[model samples]
Target: MRLVLTGTGASRGMALGRARLEHPSRYLVDERPLEESEVDAEAERLYRAIAIARDELQALREKLHGALAREVAEFIDAHSLMLADRELTSGLFELIRVGRYRASAALKMQRDRLVAVFEAMDDPYLRSRKEDIDHVIGRVQAGLARESSVEERKLAARVGEILVSDTVAPSELVPLAEHGVLGVVLSSGSQVSHSAILARSLHLPMIVAAHQALSHIQDDDLVLIDGERGEIVVHPAAQDLARFRAWQRELAQKGKRLALLRDADTRTLDGTPISLYANAESPADVAQARTLGAAGVGLYRTEFLFLQRKEIPSEDEQFLAYRDLVLGMGGLPVTIRTLDLGADKADASGLVMDDEENPALGVRGVRLTLRHPQILAVQLRAILRASGYGPVRILVPMVSTVEEMTSVRRLLKECARDLRSAGHEIAEHIELGAMIEVPAAAIALGGMIKSLDFVAIGTNDLIQYTLAVDRNNDHLANLYDPLHPAVLKLLAQTIATAQRAKRRVTLCGEMAGDRRYTALLLALGLTDFSMHPGLLLEVRETVNALHREPLRAQATALLRAPTRARIERVVENLKKAVG
Candidate 1:
């Protein structure tokens, strides 16, 4: 009998391969008491294990090249720092020498104690650091057990396998990609977790929070991973195999069709041109966007510089990064979002507060920057300096009122003045935009758009806020519907408001990247769409096949649909008409 397991579709793709379950390290070690005479020997064993773990990380670091190196370096460095931290090492030694416990037992106790502190934190990002603790301790335990060659053995034997694990770290994703691993199925994690983000960047399919994965999946079983639907089929039946083969053929054919559209102009059948932009952060992402013929970068994330670090990135460091991004676009305009460093993207750099009871509704994005003007001022200066290189725009996130947008504009001018006073050449005029993620912002965008050059609709947060559903909570997955009537009405209103004001509007959320939502967004008056570079061609193809009048008619019917079921029916009809 075929067993079907479900999870959250963390990354959007598919894979089929043999299952290779990743058994965790011995967290429950032998806790037998140690004699005083054996204490020194056990301590030596631990010391050797730590040394081995460090060397293994160093070896992996040396093997990385290009953008892959930049992506995983910080996570690996954090792990290395943990290994060298006197607090962790000293605590383990104290347990072994004073408490007379075995080497592995001492490590286990220390891991538990530290994990407790992390899990007790209010911030989800900070709380998730417990995974890092477990990973690091797992490595050390592997060293202690003299199973240092386990990874190598697994890699050698299991090429082109899907990894079924409890969790995967950001640092582990690159190696899995390089090793021909088909995809990953995690027993626990969320779609927005760092590992899932990196997997998408790497173009790897991933499923997360599959509770039955570890128990039901076994080695050598043929598995089918439908990442788009978050389903894993174990030992698929003959009909399933036939369907999967047909899907593979269709996907390949579609890929070839999209490839031919690389140089095609993005326009509807009625000859209305649409602007498609890429949301990028790294140089590799920028290169792909350039190759895909993107109009510009609609969203360039800046928070990666501030994460997994002990200090804030200096203005000069930020300037260089933004400058390179500008130059990399080959003169295309780049919209750089200011440090969005709260909520699920909290930083280790002490810049974000850790005491919020509910971070999603608390001090984050624009609120954090407004509270600390110095931080915002420095970032504005860096962005102003980068503007000297090419066309640049500054986007503010999590804005609720015209007052917040007005305040940021005031500070931007102040920073521009300071830069000129210090002998800097900057763009004479820089466009400023606000993100409409808060429901209040979307409803009140009429007053807010008057003070801004443009506005961006972040559908991910807007839907989450309007529907009152936690997108990261697997239990609420069904409730977090992007097609909810409330969400669509908010989007329609926001877009209509921006259109009436004659301000340029862009949708730069996950909804923009998904081909499924392409026509609906067009019908709702989204003239500009931005997404990952890998998704641009497919979306462009969908845009070309659409007719303006039909989409407008569908949009009219969609707005009157009072419930989610009705809204979904309207959307389905729209998709069929286009098909």
Candidate 2:
């Protein structure tokens, strides 16, 4: 029996010959459809690839003797959907469009484009997605190089979870995501990479870079990947494997416990109601939002629809997207943030500038739309027209100056007039808001908070920018602390200002998901929280269990603590008292 040493996901392969622990043979997998196939062949090929990958995963699961938990299965299905995404499949045709290139050439061209797309980005989250594309490309290229025929092939018997490397297109990963078989390893992935995001969505485990894991892992070697820890354990010892099996069961139990709490209302034993909402990016996620018992959709990020499209997402496209979300909310509030993408999110839609050197400080969010009047006009028209469908409000992101907000409102009025002229019945359904992500915006909240309809705090960017840290770097990640007193002071100040002015205030950043801060936030006298849909119930339950008066009192004192360490100490004490 081979002894396995675990580390992280996608990095779990057997170490090969002793001399070359750094490099392993990479198995290439690329698919080409024959010209004789019918129009439906593309979909058929997608499902077929998923089946091949799934079968490989099934073998591993069987050998595990049912010890691998449901979470592991979620891991498998995530890969299946990736193979089915229409966007990635569309790339195949796009690849053929340029000089009728065959499979290998098309894959290579797409690979280069994928990297270029990410290279242009400045945000670490979106920039990370670029690496996911790189992984997909490796698979497509390998499939092309190894298999010359257009015919389908089963997983090679010799093939044993070999590290597949290349630029993975978003489209190709769709089918894999649906099917959930992520045996493929990525050499490079970005936070914005659809594959990595998919992993987060379905609860799959994957490791981005373990210094060329493919070179170390042998084909089909038994491996354990710790996604949360970012380590892959290969051929683990008996005791270690047993411990992991127990850990798997423990986490599963915790998940079930969380699930049971989902339906429980977020009310304390004494009757204080907590408003819980999901932080979402797409119209499609609203269903998940509702299922999580969220009071409403807190921060509906509307950047993705416009980001990858070649043309400005036409008014009709925007209208349909907005209409779907507004109607889906079923009267629940849907706070839509308009085009928050910076250099962090690269768009070839001919509307955005590709400033490589400094995208974070470059033209994006409200600044982009204000400069491109036509782009703002198109989106505003869609928002207003769709406002008739259901509850919809506009939230602008990246506001460093009030002038940016003013320019947007001027155009919005112009759009409303045009809609009314066209005989569209419009009530006062739209609410204008701004996202306070920059330190400057937070400092100016006293004045800016009064001028806006609502103010949303984007803690992710606020923290990164305030601390002058690139969160993606391993060395600097520790600096990205949510518990920093500086961040809390900014949040408290902005919320207090908005409340004083009687304007709505919501926290839409990941901090809202930190259940530890529920009492503290409540003590700060804030009511709105928008976070990941999955975490909504857990956070709500935490809030519901608290005696608001005491929690508020303790949190008040905690906020006054001098150092981050003391703040954490207070947080721990508060959590213990509540539990």
TM-score of each: 0.87, 0.71
Local distance difference test values of all predictions, in order: 0.85, 0.63
Per-residue lDDT of model 1, residues 1-579, tens digit only = 799999988887778899988766634588889988999999999999999998987787777664455557667767877898788899999999999989899888898899998778665445666788898888898889888533453454256789998877787888788889989999987886667767987879999989999899888899999888999999998987888899889989998999998898999988889999999878988998999999999999887778767887899999999999999999999999997877445366667776566777888999999998998898999999999999999999999999998999999999999899999999999999999999999988887788999888888888878877666554455677878888899999999999999989999988898888998998898889999888899899999988866888888899999998888888888775463
lDDT computed for candidate 2: 0.63
What's the lDDT for candidate 1?
0.85
Off by over 4 Å in 1: 1-12, 25-28, 37-94, 110-133, 149-157, 191-193, 308-312, 343-349, 354-362, 467-470
Quote the lDDT for 402 in model 2. 83
| Candidate closest to the true structure, highest TM-score | 1
Winning candidate number (lDDT):
1
Displacement of the residue 111 alpha carbon in candidate 2, Å: 11
Cα displacement (angstroms), candidate 1, residue 3, comes to 4.6
What candidate 2 gets wrong by more than 4 Å, as runs, is 1-198, 206-221, 228-233, 237-242, 248-263, 514-520, 523-525
Lowest-sum lDDT 10-residue window in model 1: 148-157
